[model samples]
Target chain A: MRGQKDIFIVADNIVSPLGGTTAENFSRLVAGITGVRRQDRPEMADQPFYAALFGSMDGEDLLTEDAAASHAAGGGFTVFERLLASSVADALHQAPGIHPADDRTILIVCSTKGNTHLLDIDDHTPAERISLPGSAAVVARHFGFTQTPIVVSNACISGLLGMITGMRLLRSGLFDNAVVTGADVITKFILSGFGSFQALSPGHCRPFDRDRDGINLGEGAGTMVLSTRREYRHGLRLRGGAVSNDANHISGPSRTGRELGDAIEVALREAGCGAAGVGFISAHGTATAYNDEMEAKAITLAGLNAAPVNSLKGYYGHTLGAAGLIESIVTLASMREGIVVPSAGFETNGVSAPLNICRSLLRGPLDTCLKTASGFGGCNAAVVLSK
Target chain B: MEYITGSCVIDGEGGYKNEKKIFSFAAGSSQPAGYLPALYQHFNWQYPKFFKMDNLSRLGFAAAELLLEGWETGAYQPQEVAVVLSNANSSLDTDYRYTQTTKDIPSPSVFVYTLPNIVTGEICIRHRFKGENAFFLSTGFDPALLTRYVGYLLEAGIARACITGWVEWLGEGFKAALFLIERKETAGAVPFTAGNMDRIFKISMPCE
Candidate 1:
């Protein structure tokens, strides 16, 4: 590991179905509140599909709310831009000393589909509204960040990779601080895509359960401000992380789970923490048959079978790019509170490999934790966080 | 402290390797169709999935392939070869296409290419690289940020080599300028400093 590996996550926020603040979201998770539900929106076809959406199932309402929250009247701002702005606003306000305009600070946006809702067309909205860079530019300008923001769009791994990027920027000494944020809202574009893959569950997503069918789509935004400066003290230290491609399939996960395992092994090595050192494992746990099985194999291969594992998809319903950030922030909260959030929908041994899946909110001091995410396009990422 | 050992540029006009115009489009070239598939055929590359990726991924993939053709990242571990790519428009072309499908049942195939880093993932899959990779979107290329990040990767001992630079596809045209940055600055390898990067980025012509 480099001499500068400790990139501290000083502040974070989550805009989800449960609540807007990270504290509210954590409390809801502890109380076992799930954001996923079946919806029969006109755009989603006649059949109802289970998903997690935020504030008024009315799509138009969220868009207007997003624009209203930004205090801008239709200058081509997007729903995600609002979520990103507010979440970052909260983090910057709470974190203290995080100057968005400083050259040493860079805003990194992560998402799978930024402003994709503009794709709905309606025969009027300009095609340029779909530009991810343009959306990022709006968010950066709104926050008065001097540096033009950078976007990471690596499917579901985008959020986890965003945090990892922040840590690397600090570790590389390229920047002293990074504002990492990501969001993805369920739209006809994504819902149909996952449906085509047969990856969506018809019922509530039962992650790590024997009866698990598929995943429930979700929407939300999350933010994390990471810094290397000692003044940003007393936060979860992002110790080590690694990303790897399965190289086995684009749409499907590796059948052997070797590459994901390799990523975890390397991250563990980089963090100077062994399998036993990780007190909790916040897995990607999409609840699809393949992903859950693959994660099980990877976890066992990394010799972390005994680590208490949890998947937050049941609560937030797999917020795509926001999944990693929401999960990481909640886990950090759990660490501070000396509690372990349960794997919401897990029951009965589902996969072949042995796992210590949390059945309930386990009270324990979690000093070190691991966060992993796998996505389409054959990508897997693992990050280590410590108190 | 290191070097950009090899670089390749591609666009609507033709292809260049280190500023030498290596491939040129035929006189009758019309790009209402897939310019990328034609280039893939010209290169005689045998990856079928290349046909599925959008222009952005194809541009980055083909550019990386060209850079890796003459230059050698010999003896570097697979994971040690990282990728750091940036672009101005983050998959806007494909985003529009995916949106068109939204009126009907959105095609999952096209929807997957909506993310910019899918290009990095494509490169990784082709080379079997299980390494660190990221895709950054900016209003324009910023050499200072790019060079600093790449330099840190090499100096921090995180990556022995990296495929880094700009790849963006917008409207009817696309641009890709990829450089293979390595740890060891050997003969003929230009030192990858901020000043040199800005110079080459402006000129973008063959070093000759």
Candidate 2:
């Protein structure tokens, strides 16, 4: 596999309650900040047993009524779009030379619930209300990208896959530069949907904890600007990536970890690196009973037992489609800052393998890091990055 | 651009057995039920015992089976094949039923199939494929994105061959068309260009 273009994440931004940018979010994460809270909806008032976790963003700072009104004209974009736009703007501002409208640039957006908030409203048809294509068109129009914009809606792997798509587009000479973004907002449908599945944690999530119950749904957005190696510099290089299917179960994870491990191995081999070269691993620890165990197995299968690993679920809850990119930004930040944040809320080790769950912030110079995510449908993706 | 070496579609009629020979398109609806019986007939091979099958599974299984016909299993091991699909409504029928069950008592089995990518997983399990896989959900077809993604999969060497297409099954209507694509050394027959797409969608072929 080819290395990412000189494109660097010159700037990064986020809109979680933790803070609005990489610095603020990482600072809160290092300080062990937890953005989850109890449910506040009127209908959910009596359900004290259920708490809703959310990554609240500053709406006023992220969107304007006029902008929302423009989106509202087409029935309005969701909070997810607004947060995504803010992050995209921040990324572009950091990379001053890049322009969204450049013919050579491509925009790839990822979201499992792209304007799904519109689904809650009753004014439009199902096609119009939950229109992912329209939401993507809105983003593309905002960026003035005349080129065909690609939107990926894969479950949790959406962001990682979106990055991979952008990389492919650049390599194919389809575009010189690409902007990749992933965003999702909490909605009643998602909450009730997960609730119906009994997958929601009663309180704050405790990824990899012995008493880990389930995942706490959260929302946020992350954007990264990618260009050919000849066009940009100072960004973490995307070295290699792979995606695979367990082919074992849809909702459940494969116990053997064969398929998941193979994806990581392929990514490492493509990057011309070995397991030992990986400094740390950003795991998709969803605080669920099966996902954490399966991830531990996959890591062991990849022979990364000594590498320090952590899941940011405790910091941001499970961000669904945004988890891959959001956690990836966190991993990149850690690489830049020479510090690995601890896996917050991981008090007890439950799985058999002894994983190096960062109990506290570890400060050191790091180079290569692995970001792995697994989702519904047995979909798994792994990407390797170099500092 | 990749070439669609092999393409097939099964609707209400049986496999390669649509007497009408022409796929139907209606004004009021997105799905034309002309291929449902053919799709189900082909799918019945694996699911003979089950009283009913979900549309996603039924369509995925039928499409994949058609693509793999006459192909050597040893040469193209199940693990070397990948399924890349796109759809619009997601698993809406399943989602509707899943939501309805929540009003009384929810069934875990039904809830598991709510995610859109589950159909891809089901296909993989049925064929035992462990290769790179993805499911892109979009409102409508964008052949450009599909071509780019398929080319990426081939170039990455993640899968020797891939079954890619659009499968949307909502209400009484459903449409599924899949193409089996493999890399070529030089210009070959069955190029996956706009002409081929038009031929597959608009033209009719005589039965063998």
Candidate 3:
């Protein structure tokens, strides 16, 4: 509640299989609906797998009618770029004072993989056009952004890390506001990779459940407009944020959970809020055995064991780069409605450390919340959002 | 203000530390292709994990090893040293290789290194660094952004020291220019400025 809580969330949008807007997605979560289902796409994987994907759309068909108008202006916009543009447009439309053309504004794009799917085509895309920076530039130009766009490509934490980067830049007087967007498509590239690691679950993912197997891959996009002005309906503000590394195995979780725990502690300290002030936690519970168990341990180590925790993976099925922002937007929705959404796929206590996993809908006042994510490269990120 | 305590650049030409030529490839050698393993073997470093790394990680790991050599006892705690890196191609080098494997059974080892930040992970694991980690993507090395971001981290007390630079690899080309930044001034240390960074990065690149 103290220090500079000037960075407020002006507006946000989420385009997932569950819905095209945050309100639609949040309502579906509250009603106990899941977007994950088994698919038999021979192109994506040989075996049937569970995932929440934008169905039956390829190339320009994935773009909305409005976004397609801009796409037809010049070079084609890849599916990944289209998602970012569509989501950011909706977020910008909701905000009153934010302008993309203003020099004081900036755009930050986050994605673990952007336009890498072009490799699937026989015609080799030029190296520059296939890069994440190239996609970011295209989106920036489409929006008429006056400043250079910054692209963050960290593993799974890219979305949250992007927001943290945006927040820091604004606080440093580098920009008056920032539009942060993240998206990743479900492609054979990702499927075969995750399939090789045996990380994708066969059915709906169950977070914090004893029988939890693995994650259900998801595809979606999310955007949030953050500004120094409080000209929006939702007064949710990003109070503090921190990033850390486990220094452990590149592809595995930390054995002790101390790394993620450290990030949460530092983020809370920076927010000037005690553990008691946190209303709940929006966890990066991908439902993988190690990830959920490690997160449970980190929560207890951070002294927030009593705060009700939930993961949106069961609904959206772990949307890679978009998970952090989509989940945060849903968390803000929970705060606005004064209700805690249930952890959709949870059945029982699974982790060794005791966590207050919310298994059912709970209506209550929420003031502050913590969102966390961990990814490949042994990286972890945590952010404290307050009302 | 912070100072650049150490720096190491490795590319087709050879390896240089603090603007001094510390290692060079033999004449008529098939360079830029066998450069990373050659450097690793030349140093006689005994880390089996080095072989498992993709070219990007190997390039970064070797450069970092040279950058932090003889500085085992750093002034800051393990969590006080941050790793902030940037590049253009990202892990596309590995992405292309991994895609080849996807034609049959995908290789998990190669699949893991598809993300650009995995290099940071490997470096952190080797050095036990637990501080902030971020990997940015741009058309080229951006000294201004790194100077401003790393400076902010040091000023805000988020990190006491930082490992900032650019490591890029695609096809047959690779470049790793890493610098260690700290608040303390050493004998050969220089002021951490955008101009200095850009100049040092250029020094690391092969002549056109």
TM-score of each: 0.93, 0.89, 0.97
In model 3, where do residues sit more than 4 Å from their true spots?
A: A1-5, A59-62, A230-234, B204-208
TM-score winner between 2 and 3, please give it. 3
- Candidate number achieving the greatest lDDT relative to the actual structure: 3
Backbone clashes in each candidate structure, one number apiece? Answer: 1, 15, 0
Query: Which of the predicted structures, 1 or 2, would earn the higher lDDT when compared with the native?
Result: 1
Write down the worst ten-residue block by lDDT for model 3 chain A. Answer: A56-65
Candidates 1 onward: DockQ, in order: 0.60, 0.52, 0.77
Task: Give the range of the ten consecutive residues with the poorest summed lDDT in model 3 chain B.
Answer: B24-33
Candidate 1 residue runs with Cα over 4 Å from true position: A57-76, B32-34, B198-208
Please rank every candidate by TM-score, starting with the best: 3, 1, 2
Ranking by DockQ: 3, 1, 2
Q: Tell me, by DockQ, which candidate is best.
A: 3
Pairwise DockQ winner, candidates 1 and 2: 1
State the lDDT of candidate 1 residue by residue for A145-226, as single tens digits: 9987777877788999888878877787778899999988777777877886778899899889999999998998889999
Residues B114-188, model 1: lDDT tens digits: 777778878877877777777776667777768877787787777888888988887786788888888677666
